[model samples]
Target: MPNPDNSTPPIPSSVLILGSGVFGLSTALSLSTHPSFTHSTITLVDRSAFPAPDSASIDTSRIIRADYADPAYSALAAKASKHWRGEWGADGRYDEVGLCLVADSGKAEYVKKSLQNVQGLVKSGARQAGQGRAGKDSVQVLDTREEIERVMNTGGGSGESGYVNWASGWADAEAAMRYCRRKVEELGRVNFRKAEAKSLLYSGNKVIGVELVDGGRILADLTVVATGAWSGKLVDLRGIASATGQVLAYLDITQEEQDRLGKIPVLLNMSTGIFVIPPRDRVLKVARHAYGYSNPTRVPHPEKHSESMVVSLPRTKVDEPDQWIPREGELACRKALREMIPSLGDRPFSYTRICWYTDTPTGDWLITHHPCYEGLFLATGGSGHGFKFLPVIGDKIVDCILGKTPEEFRDKWSWPEKGKEDGVWTDDGSRGGKKGSVLDEEMRKGSRL
Candidate 1:
């Protein structure tokens, strides 16, 4: 018989986090700060190295506070922005430089509607919470294309003619992730393992521990899976299922295109369905929002930025967060950016990278206790906005671990009652008829088209 001491200690409380991304680290840091978690140990597991040499290579940081059309996400983002600047320390890593939404004259109506809702929400509760305060609230709304042009001129124009907002920006993504990870590591209660999780050890319906790729069995009282893209595969082993999404990013311009891509406020070009983020140096960042691949797999190692360019090659099912840069992808992204913003012209791209998103049919993140497992928690399906909510997610995840469900958390991530098969259902307008779930009827009303 196995020694009783070797099994989980009676009333065990240690937590095993199954990824090193922002979600895993953020949860570890928050648990350290939690009053009830003083005695708990947090074991963070990630295949990524400790102190990633290239921050961007590990996970590109694209932080923003733009309120989404979805109210639930807006609320979550507002809380996250506060924690990033307040809890994580403003000067630590995340910088609130503000963000702007841009659109062409033809799509002015769409931009206006979206911004109206965002502005209303911001002005209503966000301002009271100090989530955002537009440049003295003087020019919160840019009604004219000429005004946008003037602001664009001052911010080192996007190279293309379009209307712009003045009071928005982006955070240093690479720096923010690094800072969060560092803070978590500094907490003496947590241990980061440089190994991959090979399988889960379960008893009856509960997970008892995880078997590492190296064959070490590190047991835990509870397990939290924040595996991002590899989540589907990891969960599949345990009979849990999720969808994967593939995303890519490209440098906006090279060092030579200083006049065109530098000093620009981060922009979300609604007309083009693209987001343009201004990084340090002359390089700008650009990527499509609507286009993405489904059924992505994880790659144990990072890939180069070059391998991602070929549209012909079967899309790689990267299971892990790889940083390989495909040369052709780098060239293609740079060219596409130039086409979008003519000012980029013929400048070369310095680098490019790919990342993955855990997706859901209802488009809401699945961050709760596993429906079937008693001691397992989930923090996945951010729908691409998970990183921005790292700070707030940490607090909620810890609460879930401690068995105290907060009111705010209950409202945001409550489990769906419908669509058990494909995990999809249309919102039926009940008191709990939240819009961002698998059953959201409104958002996908015409999805068949």
Candidate 2:
């Protein structure tokens, strides 16, 4: 919780942002040009160079849709859709192909509420104007599996009922990220550093800055941690935030197959948490938006001395370059392929990777200042859906930093209370699959296969 008086913190002379992913990079961009921060020095640091290869932000594709069950997120996503349709989406960066969202009888609640939200947006004409070819008829409800199959055009259907939002689409994630990075560089207002942050430099209760892995120190008046899944290691986020690794499997297809499937809408079944984004460049992707595997490791608690705690952090290719998803995840993806696109059922996966998400208990982002630390602020907890807001999230984050959090997101983005007695598993009605999976255990199980 922020100060009860609602007094805004003084604008710092120097702001140091850790992590160059969507949150950090966007904050830097916003801080650089914002009128109030004209004299504030901005420094952006990341372990890898721009577009960190192992980052969740660096991906082949990401969904850009506003079909959320929560009206706030749906409205905000619709606002971002406008930017995606503008110059930000130029040069093949974005595509408005459409998204087929479905769910079976048991898990149909989310899809039902999502459909209603989008329909409301459409009826209010908010989802009509910038939808390109999907104008006016942007959303269409599918009453049966046959209707879902017809919209998918894949000769198959998923879930019992759903709807298709043509206004929704996908984006070349890396391209859009690079575009934002270039825009940040062109401003020349930020000092970019390629270095790994070891931990936060705490001066009593106030965070002074960051300590580098090489025993170097960089001090700043304000520090923002936007390290995504890696944030837990830099801050004590135990019950507040954790890293969950989601599985992604890609298959190489022929040019003809790509052309045939590329025109179809992105299919996502909330019931099973399986999704297949249309193929691009002869490669098709199948993934799950479920409660992902947790990689729990013991590390020195950020704010405690001679004490350690177990936190679920990311274990990516950056640490083990040869890493692949667990067999259970692979099989889940296989099942999705067999049921959705039967033609590719027997095809082998060209490659598989685990995409890490910084998940909070409620699926809301932690964008407020640390409840106890004076100079420390957090801008993470993407929970697998932050990429779509890349175009506009930074400015909103800056607003939160300045104590002007948008009314809609004030409570949603605030520092959450301690998690439940069992553990933190996002139950936002969107995530599916089993919870409480351990990464190492799953990997060993995969080895047995």
Q: For this target, which candidate reaches the highest lDDT against the unseen true structure?
A: 2
Structural similarity to truth (TM-score) of each candidate: 0.73, 0.97
TM-score of 1: 0.73
Model 1 off-target regions past 4 Å?
1-12, 51-60, 83-92, 95-97, 103-114, 128-139, 143-147, 154-167, 237-249, 252-261, 295-336, 403-412, 415-449
Model 2, 213-240: lDDT tens digits are 9899999989999999999999988888
Error of 1 at 259 (Å): 7.2
RMSD (Å) per prediction: 9.6, 1.6
Best by TM-score: 2
lDDT of each: 0.53, 0.88
CA displacement after TM-score superposition, residue 301 of candidate 1 (Å):
22
lDDT of 2: 0.88
Q: In angstroms, how far off is 47's CA in candidate 2?
A: 0.6
